[model samples]
Target: MQSAIPVSSVWRRPVSPLHCRCEEGDLDLVVIGAGYQGLSTALHAARAGLSVQVIEAGGIGDGASGVNGGQVIPGLKQDPETLLALFGDEAGRRLIEFSAGTADFVFDLIAREGLDVEHTRSGWIQAAHTETAMQAAVQRNRQWRAQGADVALLNPAEIALLTGAEGYRGGFLDRRAGVVNPLALVHELARIATEAGAALLLNDAATSLQREGTFWQVSTRSGRSFRARKVLVATNAYSEGLVPNLARSLVWLHSFQIATEPLPPDFDFILPSGQAVSDSRRIVLYYRRSADGRLVFGGRAPMRVPQSTDDWLHLERAMRRLFPMLGSMRIEQRWFGRVAMTPDYMPHLHEPQPGLLMAAGCQGRGIGLMVALGGVLARYLAEGSREALPLPISPLVPIPLHRFRRLGVAAHLAWYRLLDGLER
Candidate 1:
């Protein structure tokens, strides 16, 4: 296994600051947020001959796009059968096909861009935490297999061999899924977008957005204004209050992860096949072996932004439960990222107003979904074809009483944790 470059260190990797005029001007698209979606959309849109400008409140990928678990898991939380049943044929099939190809699209982009980074496509394992979960995996396997996905069910013995964890009963693997240093990919995407002629305004946040005449005028906190024909709010989980329509559309949660100090022998024991492993618990825990020989272990975290490392120690108990040998290992990295969840556990594309597009809720699979969706958005914007979109542009209704969402999520996580513990 290759060594994973320290994720924290990547934050300091010198991406040249935008040397050109930082002024806001006429543009085809003014994308808010420089995470995966914004960078990808900006890259594609610029290539498609659209004048693009991206505004970021902080450094690129400073949000979940860089800090996430980096597991390139595919599809929505819903299984193929459920998707078909819930969405019906046309929309369901489109969703299924779009999701199935997300992982491929991400890896393809990495390759096409000639990104020199450590990545693997060995597979992704959904290690079942209980017999019921194993049964669920079996059904998912059957459904996805029937849909021509390269998937298979793994028995307990196979699960142990693959995950190197003891508690999992069994699970299934998706060969199409994998892992990569997300920060590497996203930071590189920023470079690619810049090279493609997209203006990147780092450390600048969009404050207000309004329609004036034919163009949308986006005012930044730094007193810069950009007029664009279209706008995309790709902030995802980090959507604070720049636009209430997008900020209130989804629920936000935090996912924290800890990395062991270059556990090489542990890597030999855990996830030797290079497959990222995530359990089937409702409050799911996911782990992957980084190229730097670190085991990135993570699950649910505080519903709100963590105050410090004290907020992350809660995971040690669960970590030792799965791999008790880790009980004595030194944790070198502790971090958490924001997660956006929709009520339906599916991604949403909202057109709250004309020429203003919003995308949210990849339900933790944003890496692959956003990467692919970027191209789709680019094509759609380039051709003005709404019918070609796999996702429907639905109405923007703010989740009711979103101010109390944190308390509600904390309660739900507690209940789910109790239920998950009972199964164990």
Candidate 2:
């Protein structure tokens, strides 16, 4: 009735990564990292006729951008009421409004750029694994709908009808949520940026950064140096020793995904509407149909960095449990990526020094949120005013005893898993 196949593999991107030859020149902005955020910044900056250059350690979308679940869900990691309570009324409202439209912003960008990424706006289902969890989904629908979000509470039957899965109790559907090929999306943005005169260099990592008078000098591992008036560090979960105390400020967690071979054409009832779906649990479970009819499913990774497909046995078991119809469907691929989680489970914009801007700690909700934040950061840089930003800029605060983050995360996962089991 179930399988434990561990065929670790990488998703072959539609296009090869760009390898632009760097030139010796200064730029208006230097974006470090070619993920969604950095490339998005480059796109907006290049569109405004600014000299932009993006430096990436590996190929474009080599990091989490290539391996993410690709669910274009809206809002921050925290709920609306929680954000409202933490940030107060006016600022909270602004943050809610901005975050709610992140998916819309992404789809809009795709249509505007005529990018051929396999994107769909068939809505997103947040399924509840338990009746108790369904109550929370009800609250979420109320909170989001009050902010003008097109969300509705779904009964258990509705959940089953929408997802083709019977185990879920109930949940909510956000009309704006969707999915896309993250690799394709990032590559398209990179193409747009380069065509708009922005320089993008892959296989290049910013080794060191220093400020001199009014400009910042960035040295790459390939021995090339570039100077820029403004520096934007968008290297989220992959920020390993890139900047002082940057990596230490966030807890890095591993998220893994597994894909099944294309379901038989006759099995059309499974996610028939083609909407992306995720369950409401501390360790989130998400799945969607690929353009080729495969089921791209994902969930939490092991406490440690996952090495092989076998390391994602939990996800395999979860998938089989939810959809028993796949009695022996072969798992075609397995991959994992790191997610930068802030203590508060929210994104942070840091301006630790003048002319330097760093944004990170997405807490596993990056797809749409990353692009939205990138646009906001680009505008803030051009306007040279923090007042123009939807979220306030804050100083970097490194977590105390950050060396034990891995152990702490292990404990956190254990507790969350325990709670999830009890609730279920």
Model 2 Cα shift for residue 224 (angstroms): 1.1
lDDT of 2 by residue, 1-424 (tens): 0124433433446564454756457778999999999988888888777788899999876788877878898997777999889999989888988899899999999998898688889999889988778898988999888888889998988888888876788888999899888878888888887877788888878999999889999998988889999999999888877688889888887778888999998778899988999888888888998888888888776656655556877888888888889889998887777788888888888888888998887765698999887787888877787765778788788899898877877888889988877776
The sequence of per-residue lDDT tens digits that candidate 1 reaches over residues 211-235 is 9988899998888889999999998
lDDT score for residue 131 of model 2: 79
lDDT of 2 at 4: 46
State the displacement of the C-alpha of residue 188, model 1, in Å, after optimal TM-score superposition: 0.5
- Supply the global lDDT for candidate 1: 0.84
TM-score of each: 0.94, 0.95
Model 1 error, position 330 (Å): 0.6
Cα error, residue 367 of model 2, in Å, equals 1.3
User: CA RMSD for every model?
Assistant: 3.7, 3.1
- Which stretch of 10 consecutive residues in model 2 shows the poorest summed lDDT? 1-10
